[model samples]
Target: MFKNIVRNIFLEAENANVKKYVKQISGADKLDPIIVIKPNPTWVANYGWIAYNNAMDQFAIYNLNNNQRRDKNSRCIFHFRDIQELHTVQDGICNRNLIPNGFHVPQGLQANIALGTNNPVPIGRAYLVINLEIKKLEFLEDKKFFYVD
Candidate 1:
């Protein structure tokens, strides 16, 4: 199901840059990466604050701000700390204008994550699952960033 969505995005995306990025990442040998996302205020307001171990695997998320060419249904990501600050803002504003942040897999767990062998690295509020063999990007869940014990 999720694979089809990403496949459609790769095939039907209007943005040239997005297509190019998809090509690059899809074909790359390494997919050890992190998906950076700010808190979704709507989700929090409706469902209360985000908690650790919460699965945030929402594919085909709507683009709230479609102001840029690269803002083509991408995830919420700006600076690294936006994950922490997103839950604190009272205003409706969010990290919709920034580029998506995904980084290379660390050396230690690259094999485990790539192979999907009980590799659950703590990435702040991000839960990212990447299977390079199938060229699939799966989101795990989000966790509470601030005000946690």
Candidate 2:
């Protein structure tokens, strides 16, 4: 299911700059990296989520730019705290705008979230899953930014 979604996203999009960045992050041979969400080893998985969230935030910035282009009278300054906040806010806005009643996922996905809930486990578990699609990785070939000097 995840693979299908990723494939769809890739097929339905075209972003040259983003593709270049991903290629730089991952090796040339490895075009699409499957990042799994795990409990242990905090850095890798968390960083993956952060990157995905950042990409979404970039999309929000594009949207804001579009709004500015469309409406001359509307002046809105949007500030985002990292990509995670942008993703959360964008998801909320999308749900509110698209869905009449609101969006609801199956219980299994969010059942573990219980930080403030009146349940046995007072502390909640933080977890995330994200899939990124790269159109092309050619820009990484000549880029030294991703390398450790």
Candidate 3:
């Protein structure tokens, strides 16, 4: 439910750049990335918060869990011109920690998150997945900033 709402808000955002990146990376020129966000459903999983942060930057993740490796999905990132992205990825994937995983945060998405009654024990260390390609990584920053609303 949250994803849908966020997606819709992004679609309507102004002074932001989500729509631009969608056209550049998606290569469809039809606003596909705006709705699908790179066509990856299971986008970005995390055992804890480590890979969750890394997926947004350029520290390309390698499945830490063996059995559930196949379940990993593309980490849906909200690339924006926030204070964090300004420093790191300045050259390309610099920071290794979020302090509080700062990059994963955009428009204060972290604040909106609620521990749904069932925060189950992690089944594996499959922390984070994303559909970004190594080549298009630099293009992330070019997108306009988007707020969750």
Candidate 4:
């Protein structure tokens, strides 16, 4: 599930000091970063997209800025070792219900929707809020994952 499912949650940070934040993430031992997944009321109110999951226990990062890593806004990508680390450090409940009314499913995830099944595998987006410090995240500038389409 970890390998193929949820990978990177693109955080769009505006007016934030990225260098300082990076230093805090790398230097401080007690820096517990809380990553808010979509379907988050606060996030939806402020930004406007609810990333809902369809499968139980399926956790994935919510892309906040919708991949617009531009205009003094930087994207923070946290690389986890595995699923265990993700589960151990995470500190929130994931809504496993299918995407509710009024939520726009991004074009990137349209292909992930299951075609025909009452119980579909978790091929769509996942919503999770995680603590980065406990997971011992590593910051990689050039690290990228490839998908076979």
Candidate number with greatest TM-score: 1
What candidate 4 gets wrong by more than 4 Å, as runs, is 1-15, 28-83, 87-95, 98-149
Q: Residues 24-142, candidate 4: write the lDDT tens digits.
A: 23433333322222233443344333232221112333322354321112122232344454444232222322323223333465477432222212222223323345554433321
Ranking by TM-score: 1, 4, 2, 3
Question: Measured by C-alpha RMSD in angstroms, how accurate is candidate 4?
Answer: 12.7
Where does candidate 2 stray beyond 4 Å?
Answer: 1-21, 24-63, 67-81, 99-104, 107-149
lDDT of 2 by residue, 1-149 (tens): 33333233244434563353234334322223222111122322433444433333333344454543211111111233344554564465433333111122324534553322221110111222222344432211112111111
Indicate the worst ten consecutive residues by lDDT in candidate 2. Answer: 140-149
**lDDT, residue 64, candidate 1:** 26
TM-score of each: 0.26, 0.21, 0.21, 0.24
Report the Cα lDDT for candidate 2: 0.29
lDDT value, residue 46 of candidate 4: 42
Candidate 1 collision pairs: 32-105, 55-141, 56-141
User: Total backbone clashes of model 3?
Assistant: 14
lDDT accuracy of residue 51 in candidate 3? 49
